[model samples]
Target: MKITGSRGAKALALVALVSAVGACGLPRSGPNKAEIFKGSVLKQGDAFIVTVNSRVTRATAVTPALGFSSAFRNAGVVGSDVISPGDVLGLTIYENVKDDPLLGNTGQRVSALTEIQVDGAGYIFVPYAGKIKAAGQSPDGLRNIITKKLDTQTPDPQISVQRLAGDGSTVSVSGFAGANGVFPIERPTRTLSAMLSKAGGVTIEPAVAIVRVTRGGKTGSIWLEDLYSNPALDIALRPGDKITVEKDTRSFVAMGATGSQTKVPFETQTLSAIEALATVGGLNTGTADPTGVFVFRNEPAEVANAVLGRRDLKGDQRMVYVLDLTQPTGMFEARDFLIRDGDTVYVTEAPFVQWQKTLSAISGSTNAANNIATTGQ
Candidate 1:
């Protein structure tokens, strides 16, 4: 990290904190004093460029997002769009001939359909079979179980079970929606993107959304951009599952020599430094110190220290991120540099410009002195 002024002291302190990262988990001070970084000069490799997984590490849940995965684990049942526990199912038994007390001999081969509620236990009580596990089980599984149970009493007994209510035909969608509720699924139109559309679609752009699925106590998450890009992940929704959509909080701040210095929210959950730079209107070619573009962020001391090529130093540390954008591979490397939330990005004023301004001030002062003498004469 390169520092030109009193900021060098803070930069070294941060470097020391990372170098000492191995010594222990020393509590570091927060950036409460604006002066610590208010006018601090930054270089390309300061402790701030992000290299972790989460898009926004320093984000304080600013417009924070919440998400969940589907509630069923079985890929089989979940895929087939079958009903699970907490759902209503309808069943019918069929026999070859005459009226049987079990079938109530509807004269026809098939018995009347009966609707039953699947309890929280995922079990449904059949007339003769009593309570049987139904949650996460497929329609075929239910049919086979019921058939086996009645096989002994009747000759070649046949049974049919259909998912009446539950994940079988509906999925609950919530968040940033025109109407949040369970949407009935149309056959062949049960994918996530399709389901969201069925609910009148999300109000915000899905590409920038954070979506999660909670299923079987296990939750999975992905950005809407990824979901939209990957067709396979929009898996079938199982009964008893919930999906939540939320606005993306992942963002970064652009400061120093940019067209506009401001906080820029990521258009998509995942973005690169180059993309981030582009989003903020790039640097001011007229005044920006090209070599001084830097990103500032707090990072895991151990990891930061490891990258800086040293052993534990002391205290806590935030990184001063830099890149030699002039290099041929600069753009490629920048593309790999992921920007996190609350990250401070700055483009230093060119050294030549600063010198020129100083010289101009000196020349103006001399001219004023000469002019005062002439006026007095």
Candidate 2:
């Protein structure tokens, strides 16, 4: 097209403006595939970039293996009805002799001791039984011992011992349980799962719930859902054990051209790359480059070696894995690929998105120039 008069000058100025915008580069969601490749360790960058493939997917498909250790699983269940220190025992003694009963008056043949508490030293003192070891003995066994101890003092002494309000043989259940309190260990609540039930079960979703058992100085954790599926994980509970039901704390970050950029927590026990994308609202359809999906993570040396097929890498290695959804098996690879905690899932913008932005800037400049040219006319 031929331009004349002041219009020609405005046209030239418009061309210059467009050139300036292109030279400065248009704003974009993130670096494109080529730019990302330029940042690879092979190209003097800090990250070792690898493409997502079936082999890579298999190598990186590991999830957090959470379960009770042998220390917890091998523990045998103790008798929940056994007496322990700090337990309160209710005792009632009956004497056959009506004349001058040792533990009762002449006319009284029954003596009721409603509050006999086992001391910290595992001993309980009765009126005529002296200091007797009550801990580790069942209620019936304790009754027999008390009866024997008072046999010499009273005639045909018969004692009955009943456990009332145990304080020692108990577990403390807290954190996301339906009820948070110290629960006495009974026959029905001797195992870890049973103790959790005695506390009214976990209040949160089982898939994301974590059950932790802290006994003595060691702590073991397991997924709540696994407790039922794997009976071996339903470890036996011990006295003074503390059980806590908590939500899973694993999370990943979504950035770049994704539907939303935020730190998303794992809703299920195991999360894959595709599921993680869905959790963040998926990719930005208009700007996202389906071939430029990237996951950034600091992998341990062993994982890094397996993924890279190299054993030279040491410590935690910075790795970037690329996923191309445009490929035939790309979707399957993404579906199989696992997303771990603290990973960053980024989707770069399509190459044409930047070109489109540049065209928009040129369109604006053309309008401005035309208006100026019209005024000059």
Candidate 3:
């Protein structure tokens, strides 16, 4: 059959349409279009950077400064003294009497009476005396009171009183310790580091250890790193002060064009989004779509709902946060966009570029097959 010119043109057009359709239908390269659309908006846009400026604001609640305040309160000054129960008092007696049995027994008698404890009302129960308020009383004041009381019973009774326990003398150790409990101080002077050693030092990684001290109901935090460098911050330990050691375990998210796109452990205190990108070995230039780099972060559903004035988000619902890195400002923002633990970053591929890859792969396969056929023939 002789083909007419018009008929041949129609057939060629039809073949071309079929080839075009086949090329379009070939598996798309890079990220799937559907997947990119499903991802957060940030992943679908160009990459940009934004700079972050920190603003100073007064702390509304207890902060690191509050901790320092508590430390100062714990360390009692000259006039303001802190007295606890079970504190020991020392006493000496002087009497000029022949064959004084009372004087001979004075040492043992004073020892027993000095060990007496102060009641919850801050009053001590002296053996031969009634309740005596000792909470705010100085050692010498307490001694004078005792001497006056004893003088009424015995003529010219000489008495001396002194506090055996130092003011501010108890230490408490909690969290990540072999034996987590409070310990009594036997001596007057003790350092913060010494108390920590006594309570069994941190068992967890030093880098992850956080030490907090609470005194007089106030708290202060000291990082392990700072404690090592600044000896001044390691203030002397006082009685009734609590030392808490906690372990920090939050990680960072790594996304974009990298060997592995997943969450990576971030042990440091702060992790910038750019640093996270570098951690994953940066973007894969060959297959990466620089314009479509983004980070998808889901805010706490409750927090998002509260901020947006919406009802409770479903259990599976996520608040999508899109970050574009194509613009220079976007890059600055990425640097400031702190990559919190468990955030997801996505990098999308260009549609046209993916189409080219698909067609290239198909053409390469077809050419290889034709070569094989020709060789076989």
**How high is each candidate's TM-score?**
0.60, 0.93, 0.58
Off by over 4 Å in 3: 1-81, 88-98, 101-103, 106-114, 119-124, 135-138, 154-169, 176-181, 185-209, 212-242, 300-326, 349-377
Q: Per-residue CA lDDT of candidate 1, range 15-117, in tens?
A: 5644454234322212212323443425433244433222332231133343333332225323453555567788888886675546565466776566788
Rate residue 53 of model 2 by lDDT: 90
lDDT of each: 0.65, 0.89, 0.59
Local error of candidate 2 at residue 89 (angstroms): 0.4
Runs with alpha carbons beyond 4 Å of true place in candidate 2: 1-19, 375-377
Query: Candidate 3's residue-wise lDDT over 31-129, tens digit each?
Result: 543565555435654321222322100111112221245445346332323355555555675544434424346333332345555666677765554
What would the per-residue lDDT of candidate 2 be over residues 26-138, giving only the tens digit for each residue? 78777788988998999999899999898888888788888877888999998867988989889999998888888777899998999788899899989867899999999
Model 1 spans > 4 angstroms off:
1-83, 91-114, 121-160, 167-171, 176-179, 183-203, 228-237, 313-316, 323-337, 351-377
